[model samples]
Target: MSGALLEAKGLCKRYGALVANDNISLTVAPGELHAIIGPNGAGKTTLIGQLTGQIRPDEGRILFRSEDITDRGMPARVQFGLSRSFQISSIFPSFNAECNVALPIQAKAGHSFRFWTPAVVIESLRGPARELLGRVGLGERGATRASVMAHGERRQLEVAMALASQPSLLLLDEPMAGLGAGESARMVAFLKSLKGRFGILLVEHDMNAVFALADRISVLASGRVIVSGTPEEIRSSREVREVYLGEEFDA
Candidate 1:
């Protein structure tokens, strides 16, 4: 509560008899990387959906930078420095990587309607887009078609697009969804490098990557948060093992 950049208090959502999120509460401080992990159907993604305005909670409050955003739509949230990426690729695959990156910058700059004009001529949007691609280690691939780039690099482009708005907080839903071994390693390295630059709400299943990157880990089971602790504590938690990992998770 001291300096929370994003806070979800008493969040609850029900789909018929299935409770996807039940009174879930969490706080992410400025520039902290917070990860949420759990077994399938544990409501990790549901909570993320509610937090990002994809879905509404039956009851709760969502505060961003001390402002209430529970009623805010996705675009409004983006305007307020809140950005998110989905588990699947959401970029314009037909466009060049940099073009996809630049679109968001243009959108954020209130120029999406002027399709006939050249966005590159506008320095306000173009400059930040280039810088974002460079920051994500894709400076040289700016002209590459997004559909032709490697999967790992496309994911990096997705990140670049997210950063186009200069978000203060990022809600990443399974950033490593279909990455291979080497690609996953590369993603892990990149996220570790991004550790302190922005507050992140990471929902992932890769425990190896989670331990390597998260400042704190929150575990959930059956639509409820089991516990939240440091990597060391989570690694040794008997309850987590028995509930999610079938008694052999940590053995």
Candidate 2:
């Protein structure tokens, strides 16, 4: 845990009388994919909000690269190589896939977006944008408008934009949400290929994808982490099965 890419300790969030997150803690090691899974309203999203600086925890500490970031804002966190993709795809609908990605690259390069220079003319931003798109399996769709791309492709583009920040740890929220079987499979394969390149904290409801991609998993129930362990340990956990995985899971 000394060199953990991201660490959260005793995070607690409250909405008046309701407890959203209760002493939630987890760590993502460099190049490790850690999955967080639980039923709805288990405080997974609240926990992610705290980690991403969108929501302040009433009690907790967040550290990125061994530096305390609990007080840091979203931009500060991104500057520290922490990036995230939301469960809902956010992209520039009117812009081509390349331009959408280029904006973030441009921002990271300290360039003004107000400049009239066309994205195609700015080879510096365009070059890396294309590569990031390629990494997300959207190479051929770079010229396609984001609005026209399928839901899965838009998800990929959003991921490409996150990569534009060159994050050391990427937090993904429900990457498989709203995908059909084929699209889900594609996303699974894409995520599988990213193993060991960077640290990833994934919050997903897709059990198949979670088991396939996670090096370790943390199960949340009623705003608390019920278990945290390797995939095999989680699979063999009777409590996890009973609380979430259901009776069909062979203990």
| Candidate achieving the largest lDDT | 2
| 142-246: candidate 2 lDDT, tens digit per residue | 899988999888888888998899988899999999989998999999888888998999999888999999999999998999999999999989889788644
Q: What lDDT score is found at residue 59 in candidate 2?
A: 100
lDDT of each: 0.85, 0.89
Error of 2 at 217 (Å): 0.4
User: Using alpha carbons, what is the TM-score of model 2?
Assistant: 0.93
Candidate 2 regions exceeding 4 Å error are: 87-89, 111-121, 245-251
lDDT of 1 by residue, 138-180 (tens): 9988888888888788888988888887888999989898889
TM-score of each: 0.92, 0.93
How far is each candidate from the true structure, as Cα RMSD in Å? 2.5, 2.3
**lDDT value for candidate 1?**
0.85
